[model samples]
Target: MAAAFHVRSNSFPSRPHPQAVHVDEQLIRLRSSESASTTSSSCIGQRLCDLQDLYDSLEKLLRLPVTEQTIDKKAVDKLLDGSLRVLDFCNITKDALSQTKECLNEIQSILRRKRGDLSSEVKKYLASRRSLKKSFQKVLKSLKATDGDESLPVFGEAEALTISAFRSLFSFMSESTTPSGKWSLVSKLRNHKRVSCEAQTANEFSELDSAFQSFAENKSENPLKMEDVKRLESCVQDLGEGIESLFKSLMKYRVSLLNTFGH
Candidate 1:
């Protein structure tokens, strides 16, 4: 029996598994790239996708029996706590994204009718955007407050990276919605010329803001363009989809951790 077992063990060499360090490295590279890149919708969408991929890899690593065995109860508790906090962040982000999309849809609907004045709808949309921005700012503040609290040997690196990514995401969202002096800048640009360098360099949200601002200021002369609304809608749709996927991944990771460590 011993000879047979020994032969079987030799026949099946141990398979190599993914290491936490590898995921940590990927997260680091992602963070570095994100910092250097513009916070355009495309870049943010890609960040969301990359974050989901990292979480998928993390789920696989955590599911490994060897990895789970190495984590003590104390570590598991810490991970669980962190996981819950992340889930909260994910939920809040999803809610905000949904609200923003709804506002976009409402604006598009109003624009489609070629109505006399879109000031009311535009005002509503801008108000919604401001509210969402405030929500994101609050979430970011909470995230910042909890930074560096997690120092677990096994999972601290992953948790820190996750928090950092969320911070970047929320910060981008906040800025995109309500950049400082965006209204003043738009107003100045409108007085000088219809299109300028500033408009060319602005992101989708900024462009949408300018469109709405123009429509509100001079509805009869400068109507809310359907094309601009459509473009903003597309951008928001992509972001919403990305956030939804990331939220699902987070839930999966949290559930897996709970199943493994909740006992």
Candidate 2:
């Protein structure tokens, strides 16, 4: 007998944009013997498509100016909507991965029971499972750090920090940290850490947090000047590069793991 699984694309909530990009729902039926290979490949394909769509949306959003006058609020809202869709899709992918991992674990357990031993192939399969989980975790962390929670600021505090970091990165701001800009002072309250684990990224994020706090203190603000807009644009470009690198690493590992099932 074969088992059947259906993966559906999630529809987004209404926003400024009336329509969201369309993604197809996929249904895959797997024979008992083919369950591992078939399900893994099908799910991987669906996830990849969703991720590509998200990357495209972000790339488009990245083009908009940060300042008020020239800024395209409509485009910004559209991109925000797209980001929410991506978040939903990633959650779906995570669920599918969980189920797949559980299925593999069950099979591994049964094999161990029947043979009273684990073979070389079984060991390799288990290793792949662990690797997949780690890779997926990285993907989730990076996306959440960039996408941020739903709030008025659009770019969440973390994103604000990222923007702040970019200003310093481009030498648009002084290198000296404002009193509020210290990581311990600012980041201790935040739950999420910097997207990348590296020290340099962390330092950049710290700078951003400080800069954002300073901005907050100022209260009154003006539309971004042209120079500010250009600087923020450069910042987004830097951020996008990092995001692309993370996604590429995740895709490569995930595909490699699925291939272990000989897809």
Whole-model alpha-carbon lDDT for candidate 2: 0.32
Superposed on all Cα atoms, the candidates' RMSDs to the truth, in angstroms, are 10.1, 24.4
lDDT of each: 0.64, 0.32
Best by lDDT: 1
The sequence of per-residue lDDT tens digits that candidate 2 reaches over residues 35-100 is 232211112222233334433432333332221222234534533454344444344344533443
Clashing pairs in 2: 181-210
> Which candidate number has the best TM-score?
1
Q: After superposition, how far is residue 234 of candidate 2 from its true place, in Å?
A: 39
TM-score versus the correct structure, for each prediction: 0.76, 0.25
